[model samples]
Target: MSELMKIQENLRETARKLLANGEASLVIGYALGSEVSRVVPAFISREDEVDRLVWNPLCINNLAKYLLDYRHEPGKVAVVVKGCDSRAIIRLLQDNQITREKVIILGIPCPGLINPDLVAARLDPGAQITVAAVSKQDFSLQTGEGTFTFTRDEALLKKCRDCEQHTPVIADFMLGEEIPPNDPGDPFVAVKTLEELPVEERSAYWDKQFSRCLRCYACRNVCPACTCRECVFDQAEPCWVAKANNLPENTAFHLIRAFHVAGRCVDCGECERVCPVNIPLSLLNRKILKDMKDLFNVPTPGTSLEELPPLGAFTKSDPDEFM
Candidate 1:
């Protein structure tokens, strides 16, 4: 068995024990989606159903967001997380959205996820994946029709390119042997490249991206940092943001949402992935993240529970630039 298959089997067994022993009332993992190239979040409450659990390069959903759904429930919830998704777990814990005692984290040292769109373009329609293997430099997929391979650089998710956290920083249970960490390359390369553009050019670039937005709010909805019970966009009385899909309203939504999660956004890149129009929301979030790192010397939010957000905490030695 490949490492992924081994992990998948281990995950199922772990989840089964958790549910059977009453340790967890719910186990959230990924299962094969109806489509050939898709994997959907699976919610398993019964031990018998644990066989449905799966792990693959396509298990891309940030399962931590679903923990919010069960936060107030009576029993504990177990969740599977990759390095990026594990950050969301920390975000929830720090925000007090979910208590640590109430959730069990099953962390996986992710190799990386493939770009579904890129895979879809290469595969025949409805081609079923039989197996997948990951190596240091590429991933091979054995489909019903044939085996296809792509270099990590060619097929890995954009967020994975500069991934600093391949292994989860926190986990109640680790599902597999720890994978070696990748070199912490320039995490802000995209943001810095965009910053190099002229002021008007930058504005035009964002305007174009925002203009294509369908206002489906998939980005906001999928965002683990966006845990507001009543989001400002949903308000009707004062109407902080209009429901219209025009550029001004869209711009307002994006900017306000970004600032709201400025210190809290874990950079899971879910917002960018779920976006139908393919807005580079990660770039926007990372730009703010770079600023926070430069100004406050704060480590990334969600990396640790003890570290207070730069905006959430007051420090005596803080720079007095504004003062």
Candidate 2:
């Protein structure tokens, strides 16, 4: 069997068994979408639905975030995961939100996922397009114009371009071609340049950037970790920040959102993807992430559930920045 087929077949067999045994109510994984290059998450509730599951480069949505639905009953589920996704699952376990055994994981070595939307915008601006495949630095896409090749750097999600993990850190049943582990280094060169700027320059820089906020709060709403029953943004009695679209409030809103995620964010880059204004909010989170590593020497909170939340834990050597 071709390696790809073997990976897909292996996962389907697992899904079929899980469904047949009633071990899970759903198997959340990507399926071919109606779009030319679309991959949609399938909530497979039956063995027959296993046919729709697919493994490919275009499967970019972080399905782990969907588990935040408040009404989901207590039962096991199956989820497909990549390297970074393992960290997300670990974080959920650390919080005692989801038990380790509740979900069957199909871990796969993640090379990287290309950002289709970014490609569409840079070239066609408003054209409909789908990524057919990505082989290292080149991405093939079917656009309104025709099929084309684009450099991966131009189309890759910023976080993915700097991704430090290529192999699944945790898995019950892994699929796809095995790849070597990626270097776990400070990959935030661009963010570091921004941080090196003077405080006044940084303030002025984000002023123009955050000014574009529409107060849509799509970032917070789509986040899996922001699963509070009632978000602080909606609370107006105490008025933590104004509901208006002013720059000050917008800055506070973005800052607070990043601060809240400090060590907990899994760096799925969902907040950046969901933002309509095209803000690079992940930079803020990465700043804190660097501090979490340098100052506390802690693995970013969600990287593993064995450790407590960085802010939730205290030690003698902790940095005085938060003090």
Candidate 3:
């Protein structure tokens, strides 16, 4: 059996046992999407429904944020998490959005994931994938038509290319064998490139990117760090930012949000993934992350709960720029 199938089987059996024994009230996983190349979030509460659970390169979403939906529920909410998603789980725990006792984490060590759009383009959308396997080098899918193999360069998601963590940092149960971490060369390379540009060029570049904003707020909604009960952008009484979709308003929204999540952003790249206009939000957020590192020597946010966010903590050695 392929590694993907083994992991999928383990995930299904574990979820079944968790539900059948009343250990968990819910199991959040991935199910085959409408297209063979895509996967959607599956919330399974019954043992029989565990068969619907799947593990493949297409299971790309960070499922940790959904824990917020069940935080106040009766029993523990079990969730499947990859390395990146596990960071989100930690973020939620640190923020007190969900207590660790109320959550059951099932972790999967992922080498990488395929880009759905690229996979969809290679195969017929209606094709049913009978088998799939993911490796450090390539992704292979067995369909009714035939077997298709895509090199990592051809199919891997951009976010997964520089993945620093291959295994979840924390898990109640590990569903697969741990994969070694990849060397993420210069996580701040892009940020440094932008910094070297002239101030006028930098402003013009962002102005162009922000000008395409639809004000859909999809980035904010999908962000795990944005856990505020009522976001400032949505407040009409105070009207911090107008409802208009112009460049000024849009720039304000993005800039304000960047600052808000400055030290808290986990670098999950969901904002850039969900944006309709293809905004380089990861770049923007990483710029702040790079600054935080340079100024206070901090690692990526959500990587650990033991350390406090730079802005959330203070010390005698901290730089006081204003003074």
Candidate 4:
């Protein structure tokens, strides 16, 4: 069996024990979706349902957001998390969205995941994937029709290109062997490229990207940092943003959201992943993240629970730009 299969089996067994032994009342993982190229979040509450949990390259959804759904429930909830998703877990804990003791984290050292759109384009319609394997350099997929392979460079998700964290920083129970961290060489290459552009050119670039937005709010809804009880965009009385799907409204929404999550975004890349119009939401968030790191010398939020967010903390040494 490939290493992933072994991990999948271990995950199932762990979930089974958690539910059967009353350690957790719910287990959240991934299951086969209606389409072979898709994987949906699975919620297992019974020992018999643990078999529904599966792990594969296609399991890309950030499962941490679902913890908000169960925050008020009485029993502990178990969640499977990749390194990036684990950051979301920390985001919630830091924000007090969920208590740390209320959840069990099953961390998986991700090898990386394939971009679903790219994989879907290559797959035969309705093709069923039977096996998947990953190496340091490439991914191999065994489908019902035949086997296919792609170099990690060609098929890996953009977020994985400079992945600095392969092992979860925090986990109550780690499900797989520790994977070596990617070098993440010059992690800000894309951001730097944009930064080098002329002011007019950079403004034009974002204007074009934001113009294509449909105002669907999928980016906001999927974002783990967006936990406001009443989002500004959704307010009807003040109407912070008009509902019209025009460039001005769309740009306002995106800019506001990017600022709102600034210093708090874990850079999980889920907002970009779920966008139907394919907006590069990660770029916007990363731009702010880069600025934060450069200006405040603060480490990325969610990397550690003890590190306070720059916006959330006040220190005597904080830069005094006003003076």
Candidate 5:
């Protein structure tokens, strides 16, 4: 069997046992989307429904935030998490958004995921994916048409290509074999490249990107760091930001958000993934991440629950130039 199918089978068995044994009332996972190349979040409450769960390179949604919907609900919630999604779980835990007792973490060691858009571009949209496999070097799909393969460079999601964690940092139950994390070179290389640009060029680049903002707030909605019940952008009493779509308002919104998640962003790349205009939101977040690292000598957010976010904690030795 292909590696993807093997993982899917294991996931189904695990979820089935959780539901059947009353260990969990719900299992949040990925299900086959309308298109074979796409996958959508699945909530399984019955043992039979566990079969709906699947694992593959295209299973990209961060399932961690869905736990909030059930945090107040009765029974334990079992959530499937990739390495990136696992970080969001830690974020929620550290924020006290959800209790560990109510959560059952099903962790998956992701090699990387294939870009579904790239897969759709190459295959028939309606094609049924009979089998799928992924590795460090390439991803392959089997369909009635035949076997199709793409080199990692050509098809891997950029976020996956730059990912630092393959095995989840925490798991109540690990669903797949441990996959060692790949060395993605310097994580700050792109940030450094952007920093080296002229001041005028840097400003112009961001202005051009932010100018196309629809303010749909997909980035904010999908962001795991955006756990606020009533976000500042939506408040009318304080009227912190107007509802306008102009470049100035949009730039203000983006800057305000970048700072809001300054030390807490796990660099999951969901903000960039969900942005319709293709704004490099991850790059913007990473710039702050780099600065936080340089100034605070801190590790990536959500990697550990023991370490507090740099901005959230105060220390005597913290840089004080701003004061």
Candidate 6:
């Protein structure tokens, strides 16, 4: 069998053992959602539920976010994670949110995930994905008319396409082939391009995009890092920013949101993933990440628990100069 099949078998076997022996209360993995959606996340509570789990293109809804929600629960939980998901786990561990001891990590070596929206935009929206194949550089889907192909670069999640860390930084029960080293390509080109534009033109560009924001806060709500018990924006008495759809408030909301995740944003790109209006939220995040990298040689919040994030941990000689 191919590596993918072998990995799937191993995942199923491991998940079954955990659920059967009551080692885990639930095993979070990908399962079929319905006719339209390719693969949705499944919570496998019983050994019998093992058959339901399957991995595929649209298994992109992050499972790391589930750890925060599940950490409060009683027993251990088993969750599948790709390279990116594991990085989020590292961030979680760094923040002391979830103890590494409480959960089992089933790390999958990801080739890449497909963007159904991107595919559908090119083909008929109603066209069904009969069979989808993937390789390091290509993604092909069989439609009713003819099989269509696109480069993996074109089909991948904007954040994932440029992901340097393709291996889970941490995992107990890792499956699949060894991950290759991260490519040395800058994924923050959009952010840099925006920075290159004249201040007036840049303002106008963002003014148009931010103006379209409906103050829905979908981006904030879905963010793994924004998991505060009582968010400042939700608070009525000293509202951090006004809860209006005006450009100023909307822009502030986004800016503040991005700033909150500054050094810590794993560039998971989920913020951009679920936006109703396609705002390249990751661009904001990538800019902050780049700045943090420049300011402090630290690229990410250290995966270890003792280190405090930049928001709380202030250094004496921090640069405040504006070049």
lDDT of each: 0.89, 0.75, 0.90, 0.90, 0.90, 0.76
* TM-score-best of 2 and 6: 6
**Which model, 2 or 6, shows the larger lDDT?**
6
Q: Which stretches in model 6 have alpha-carbon errors above 4 Å?
A: 118-133, 140-150, 302-308, 311-323
lDDT of 2: 0.75
lDDT of 5 by residue, 118-192 (tens): 888888888878788986678998888998998998888988878888889889998888888778889888899
Better of 5 and 6 by lDDT: 5
TM-score of each: 0.96, 0.86, 0.97, 0.96, 0.97, 0.88
lDDT of 1 at 229: 90
Q: Which has the higher TM-score value, candidate number 2 or candidate number 3?
A: 3
Clashing pairs in 3: none
Q: List the residue pairs that clash in candidate 1.
A: none
Per-residue lDDT of 230 in model 3: 94
In terms of TM-score, how similar is model 5 to the real structure? 0.97
- What residue pairs are clashing in model 2? none
Error of 3 at 105 (Å): 0.6
lDDT of 3 by residue, 120-223 (tens): 88899999787889766789988999988999878888888668788997899999889988787888888889999999999999999999999999999988
lDDT of 6 by residue, 1-323 (tens): 54555777788899999888888888999876554335678898988879777765667877887888799889998889887777777777777788888889888877777777776567665665555566777877666878788888778866577766566667788877867856747766777898999999998987888899877888877677877778877888897788767989888888888777877777777888888998878777888887877777665553434556666577876665863
lDDT-best of 1 and 4: 4
- Backbone clash pairs in model 6 (N, Cα, C under 3 Å; residues 3+ apart or in different chains), count: 0
Q: 34, model 2: CA deviation in Å?
A: 3.7
Q: Pairing residues by index, what is the TM-score of model 4? A: 0.96
Candidate 3 lDDT? 0.90
Task: Assess the local accuracy of residue 248 in candidate 6 as a C-alpha lDDT between 0 and 100.
Answer: 91
